[model samples]
Target: MPDLVPPMLPATGELADATDPARWAVEFGWEGHRCVAYVRRGRVRLLSSTARSVTGSFPELAVLAEQAPPGGLVLDGTVVALDEAGRPSRGPLLRRTATLTPDAALRAEVPIGYVVTDLLWCDGRRVLELPYRRRRAELEKLALAGPAILVPPSFGLDEAELVVRTAEQYGLDGLHLKRLDVPYQPGRRTRNWLRVPLRRRRQVLLAGWVPAPGRPDRIAAVLLALPGPEGPRYVGRVGIGAADADARTILAAPSGPPPSAVPDGVAEHARWLAPGLAAAVEHRGRTAAGRLALPSWRGLVPDDERDDDLLDMPAAGGSQGGGPVSPDPVRDTGTRARDEARSRPRADAGAEARSRADAEPRSRAGADVHSRADAGARSRTGTDARSGAGPAGTDAAPVPAAGPEQPGTWHGPLSRRLEQHFVYNTLNTIASLVRTDPPRARELLLGFADLSRAADRAEEPTIRLDEELAAVRAYLQIEGTRFGARLSAEIDDPAAAGVDPGAAVPPLSVLAAVRRGVQEEIEPVPGGGAVHVRLVTDPGGPSCRIEIRPADAVRDPFVLFSVPLDVPEGL
Candidate 1:
């Protein structure tokens, strides 16, 4: 079932968004092993993004045969050398993605390579000659291969400057834009995409934080991002001081980019790089002092940040809101739903929890960090699904059924699983907003219903009402999610709906009679009232009987525990 969790395919944001034909196979595949993934003799094979099969290097991709879609196909992709973070940039990858066996420079980094650019046969379709736009559309639909097939993270904004501004403010990379009509040109690079990055977003030689000159009571600024060995060139100071509580928290931290190979010239001033004092700065821009521009210290004095909640603005290309939270919409969604959010008395704990989810969860080897299965399974990045509902609160694209059993190797099932999970989670997430704020939950419900209907109607796996509850709980818990089932239900006879309806029952009939068993457990809180029972015998085969208990609050008890302990898995 874990395998059914989609592979972690890279999002559209990761690429160069090339539209022209000159950059092909040059920038990303500049050197190192270039391999493509394909199916031959019922086995998955690796090929160079340039169409050359280099299957031996990555034998794991070949083992993907059983999970591949039912088709013989080929693809153009890169064997991206990953970094400590799992995913790698061409520039960084060039220095890292290598096999240590013989070439140290080639196998420069650990955790080796991930296959990120698949442009070929996926789901039995030949997308090679298709325009970059169409092929990418299908490619995006491919299942996650761990960190493989990393669709580069992309950002669409009103303008490039605004993107750069926001990235700096958030201390992140700027933007990458691609044309909607470009064609796929393997081994070719075009200007179909644009990247306008913030100066502070790039890697910098950490120096130190400048104290409030003589005040010593305040950290006036963080001395980070230098071009040479001069370390701690003292980038401009951040006047945005924190409250006493925040000050204490900030003062008790470590610095220096969290211990790493200090690169080349950084050691010259490494002595100045003080340990402890991590500053969560929003990279504003580059300062004339060879430092990050007016950076704002974000996590220093956390009050209540709206962006960290499930209720906060969401969906793909979230502009007026924050950009793609991560690669998947689920993780970001879950992060937002974190109950401890907002109301937290201190920002440190909240930041820690959120950061933990954001940074950790290392992608396993042979895993495509960008594969949809892996990425979708772990957490929702809050990015809108290209086919499903837009982040604008709408219905979803029709999707196929999914299950934990299906292989996350192919494009279709993996996507279907993600789509199903997305719908199921969205429907189940409950909070004060869903109950007290029915309007918003209702708005979200409309979209969920649309997605469910679409998935139900498609070849996608059928969703059990119980599974919906579980997904919703898992994904929406942090946000605000509620629970319900037994819509359009009916009892054969109201009188018989009472206790002890006469009938020769099946062994599993006990599952439907949950009120008569397990959930009959919890006692009411201090002064709360006792629970109740409700039975709705559907006009169909599977009739239902439910008990309302303090603990078993769900309309269907199966969601909590598999009664009779015989239900199929993934329900």
Candidate 2:
């Protein structure tokens, strides 16, 4: 057989200096079918984001091929579903294409627009070298005067965010923010684009680690979880483990203090961990689908509350340490713990006092969520919560004012951020099942369905899975190698100084996630292994660099993709 052609790369990392505006151009990202389309000799080939073929389903676009700019070219466009109005309804289109055939009547009535935004091919030329503006210019002139495709509007970074806001408000899919300067990276999901969409947050439990093969001390990250369709969902892991000096100092210490209780499970493997050491965890999001979005450490909570207590909150579950309101995880929860979360004689007064006295602004200083109106978010679960909206465990969505019924719209950016997290974690939870107990995975997912319907939503997973997911993520990483999971995560720790016997960093679960993301390196644990993956964050923040020790495979000194604030100053 002839030499096999290698698959084109799907992930790209540019030169280190990407911060320069001149180094980047920004564009509003559109929401629709994420396909990389190509046309040659009046023939169209529609591909999934993963490059799988799906041209048969989009015959309308195929028929309109005669109108494509007369040459071999490709473009990224959204095949969006439009209602009677020109408005976009993403979910419907995705459903139709994935599940059924769109008949001519339905097709004509509910038109699918190939909204082209970028031009990858020209009549007889390739516009790969041109700046974003020039390539888009080429696309605008394409004589695709057919009912199938239309050129979507474009805007700079300043207006892209506006586009994002408007789209969500108008029932369109989320906006996409792209870097205009980069070349047309075929099949590459470059960081040039940031999908500015809203979603939910799901907090998870951080478990154990699966060290990257070669790297020492420097771990890939750890395993993490949240309750999922399965018992406990394996959202993913931090991957890069206890490498940072400060992170290691904090993580190792929290595993001990005087003497840890040494749970039978933790004692079986991991070589360390006194057991009773309970730290707080913070995950950036959760999805109705049961995935942990962006996750990382908030640091060790006071040993006072059992770790499960931190995991079992009615609202922001599993993020007690260094989460939401700032204070000693131990001391902070102290004043509020006994205050009767459900029945407060002076609840409003207590909320106002805690809101102000704690100085924990409804949101953080630089947090994007800061833009939210306090009255809108702090109203118990929502304004209705303050006015007896339902009990904490009942409301799927509690908004400040009962506006038109919007199913997925959470309150503020924080709420939106949380929503995004829920999606990511839900997926992770499913993945955790696939990784840990491939056989029992179905059973686990069934349980999650039960939880989704149960009134005692306050409940969580019974499984303790830090190490299990780590092994599974390893398998996933190997498969996902073709596509990059570029994660941007941030973890913070406020009261490490108060840590008894120690402080901790991204936690074991974080390390496991990083390890699993890279794939190939399947470590041999004393017990069975797991798969886990975590998040990657952006740049510029105060942090103590925590570098894992020399391990077998990982060679990079430190991959500082996140900003963690939980570690104490020094070892």
Candidate 3:
């Protein structure tokens, strides 16, 4: 069969609050392995996301060859096996994908159907650059359908929200939003298409398992983690539900070293497993220690599946709590040329900065240089490098050099930080609100988008005081959503405190302080607590002070960070 490449992957993000139906196409997101079917002379070959041959896994999909147009065509879609009620079944789907060449009996038992979504190659021509609307129209003209083959209908843009609800009601993953005007982008995770997941689920690596309380052979909970630089970094464990028999059996066979460095108590009873075992885990929130909070088993992840989604480890040369931590909806997009050009210089600078940081001693001086290097790299790339989380927009203008009027773009001792746990927990919080309080969920989702936009400017050392306050507000609002009445936060206007609203302060300084306070004061307390952040001009120097403290406490605030009021000459 002719070679067929994997299709474009959608960037994860929420639907834009102000999306125009005319400009977008909405489709129910499928929960299955991405497959691209290549038909040639009535023969068929199916390729997975990693370009591995999966034709034998679903023999029924070969009917697509008979349904194809005169010339062979390449179709992109997901292969899903359905349950009794017709919802996509993750357990059976995993079994089908892992078996590779399932016999006729196995194929019949877990019959998989191909959900054709996009057309890539048609009439011996690659249609990669056609606008989504035109490409979709071309796909529909082929009339590709059969007993095991499907051409799922794309919902109109006006039905985006309705589609999301329907998907949720039917236990589907979520909705995929595609820009009608954009060309099909293959391999690249662009913002032209966006994925909004109604459920808060993650694929986690299975490091080991804890025996059931009374029955030693039975699993109480399975240890979970993501692949780390040295080994699997433990996230948290999930209680094995009745449906997790497959996961239990895999965990029963221990192999390799312990998944991660476990605590003494956990290490005593924890059984280790070989790498490659992973599971779909659903959780509510995260613990203070960054572990998955109350995770439950979903299904086993096939070994052949790529771990791109499971590789949540922090990127090299980044802060412990700093990286691209926003959920899929926060991605930004730009031209391929611009991205490559911008990335090359930043990569070089980042390498040099890392080298300098490594050579320097663990002192404020070293950190100062490191921060400056990071700031320099970010300033150079500017907002053009930002990934699109909403409708694609024009590239943002580069930040002007620091001057008397412009805020200085120089990171100081305080660097921007966004914890990965926060992203996951915030998503879980949004997921929990979807069914019972969708309005609240949408509000929080918009708030999260705002916060993500703010965090995306991590390279900006300073921003308008009002912007910083707004970010702090969004941060607190999402936290409140997650914590409800247990956690309260307030951001008093700097203007009320006699500070200039237009003045610039280090980006994320106030947010980071509030985050720290929430972690230390509210999260640790059983009853939770309140955090208050307000800015005031320093009495001692020409700088603004951000005081983060407990709202009801009498003790002095733990940490006080200052933002310089005056830009240095010739900076």
The backbone clash count of each candidate, in order, is 104, 101, 10
TM-score of each: 0.33, 0.33, 0.38
Per-candidate Cα RMSD to the true structure, in Å, reads 20.1, 22.7, 23.4
For residues 260-357, could you state the per-residue lDDT of candidate 1 as single tens digits?
Answer: 32334434333333332223354534322334555654432112232221121121121112211111111211122223333422122122322322
Between candidates 1 and 2, the one scoring higher on lDDT is 2
Report the number of the highest-TM-score candidate. 3
lDDT of 3 by residue, 1-571 (tens): 2475647888888877327888887776877888888887678898888898888888887787777666788888998876433456566788888876888788756777788888888877778678988888888677565456666656557657655544544445578888888887778888888887665455677788888777777887788886543447788877767754464456445466775557788888887776656566665333436476567676665433323333223222211112121122211121111223331211111223223222221222223233436433111112111121111132322211222222223222112122423553565455445546767766775666556545534444344556667778888898887687888776777558765555544456556556655665456556677665644333332333333344444433332233343322222
- Please list the residue runs of candidate 1 whose C-alpha ends up more than 4 Å from where it truly belongs after superposition: 1-35, 47-57, 67-71, 77-118, 121-126, 140-175, 196-474, 477-571
Q: Give me the displacement of residue 172 in model 1, in angstroms.
A: 7.4
Sequence-dependent TM-score of model 1: 0.33
lDDT of 3 at 273: 73
Identify the runs in model 2 with alpha carbons over 4 angstroms from their true place: 1-11, 14-16, 27-53, 60-74, 77-117, 121-129, 140-289, 293-295, 300-571
Q: How would you encode candidate 2's per-residue C-alpha lDDT over 1-571 as one tens digit per residue?
A: 1111111222233223235544443332345676667776678887777667777767777755576555567766667664322244454576568645667765544456576667766666767668765776666566453445655445444333343333332333245555666566554455664554433222234444434457644445555544332233344554433335424532443332211222344334342322322334434233323344455544444333333323332232233323223134322221222223213111111123222312211122223122223423111212322232432334432222111131112223222223222222332344344435544443433332222212112122111121222222332333232232332222223233222112212222222223322221222211212221222122322222212112233322222112122212332
Give the Cα error of residue 162 in candidate 3, in Å: 1.2
Q: Against the unseen true structure, what C-alpha lDDT does each candidate score?
A: 0.33, 0.38, 0.57
